[model samples]
Target: MFGLPRNRILKKKKDFQAVYSRGKSYANRFLVLYVFRSNGFQGKVGFAAGKKLGNAVKRNRVKRLLRESYRMNQGAIKEGVSLLFVGRKAAVDAGCQDLEKAFLALAKKAGIMAGDVEFSIEKRKNCR
Candidate 1:
């Protein structure tokens, strides 16, 4: 299962709205990230893939990829913040590694990730 727990997820519409309206945002080719400092000690996250992305399957896949990327890099993220990731239409065709890199880049730019940690994706060469 995805490592994100219930307490770590931003579930309500109001929470999402707050992040969207008041939080600082950053984007890359595949994703848009909204980050808000919160009163709580732990970070909370939400993933959104709009209808324009495609059918339910496509949207879910995009969301799953975003969640997985966040889950993988959760440790380096700063506490007391809520993060919301919105997937771009191009994300539907992207691989997980691409999404992960984009997510980490945006998070780092937003100053959410710790400074000492390095987040990088390994390149895979196609074998003929």
Candidate 2:
């Protein structure tokens, strides 16, 4: 019930390259975003966690965080866009909230968000 569907993912090397070559990039402290407007009229996303980030376990965990964050916020994005969310080394130890904040910020910067929608679910929390 909480899985990102296959159709919503970009699964080809060439597709990833298309976004890499033609898309505009935006970055924040926690993540890197690449956005390309596509004619397919669907919002497809891909994730990248380089080897330099960490071993398989850490990289995979980061990608999982990114995927869930993006999936939760995907509805706010415009149709016909391909987005790549790249994880930074810092994300290996970061919480989901931090990554989600970075994801939303980058989406806004990329100018792909449907509108000025607010993710006011909690705004912030104190776990202390």
Candidate 3:
């Protein structure tokens, strides 16, 4: 949708571990983001929500929100990179717009994403 194209999502255990171990991390109100450059043609994005966030349902809901946000905002991402978004407990109760803002904010801060992206969520609240 929009100008964002279909890109592969990161799913391998090794990849996740590498991102956690090697990438630089940035924290926001809703999520902890880790970014790494990869050898692929497109960027790979992953989401992780621990049990501390809540039960499976709650965790999955946070992941789903992140996934949707990432999908819509993928056009800002560069190719051949790996990004991992580890959900914070606060994300379990966050709205999609809020979470999207937090994710993009973190990405921008990390310098992996360039230019200003006017997302659907306009009002920037206390989203770190």
Candidate 4:
């Protein structure tokens, strides 16, 4: 591919809850973001779409796009962190690329990018 990084997929309900409860949030035209510290080795990431977004098909599409974006950009994200990508209703109608952009933008706003090196390293080390 285009030399993108791999995404560690988040799969558990409890992990999603942990992020939702403690993570700080940011919003954009199509997405809302939340991030929280993770327990080392058990750290995971997740995504969620509400019923207000649409039926199952649309909601799943939003989730898929968000997950794919997270996967491609994971290398740039801090490790041992749980991230939650929440989809706005508009996201149901938005193009996949646009939604991906929105997620990344929110990630930056939440200070989860490479520029946040010090915080990330500290967070990761603390979790260990």
Candidate with best lDDT = 1
Give candidate 2's error at residue 76 in angstroms.
1.0
Tens digits of lDDT, candidate 2, 18-109? 88888889998788899888786257889999999989999999998898888777778888888998999889888888898889888887
Best-first order by TM-score: 1, 2, 3, 4
**What does the lDDT read for residue 115 in candidate 3?**
67
Overall local distance difference test of candidate 4: 0.69
Error of 3 at 120 (Å): 4.7
lDDT of 3 at 46: 78
Backbone clashes under 3 angstroms, per model: 0, 0, 0, 0
TM-score of each: 0.89, 0.88, 0.84, 0.76
lDDT of 4 by residue, 59-116 (tens): 9988877776666567777766677788888887876567667776777777778775
lDDT string for model 3 (1-128, tens) is: 44333446667798789888888899977999998876751477778999999999999899888887887777887666788889998898888888888988888788877566565665534232
The 10-residue segment with the lowest total lDDT in model 4: 119-128
- lDDT at 90, model 1: 88
**Model 3 segments beyond 4 Å from truth?**
2-7, 40-42, 120-128
lDDT at residue 106 of model 3 (Cα atoms): 87
Models, CA RMSD each: 3.7, 3.2, 4.3, 9.1
Lowest lDDT 10-mer window, candidate 3? Answer: 119-128
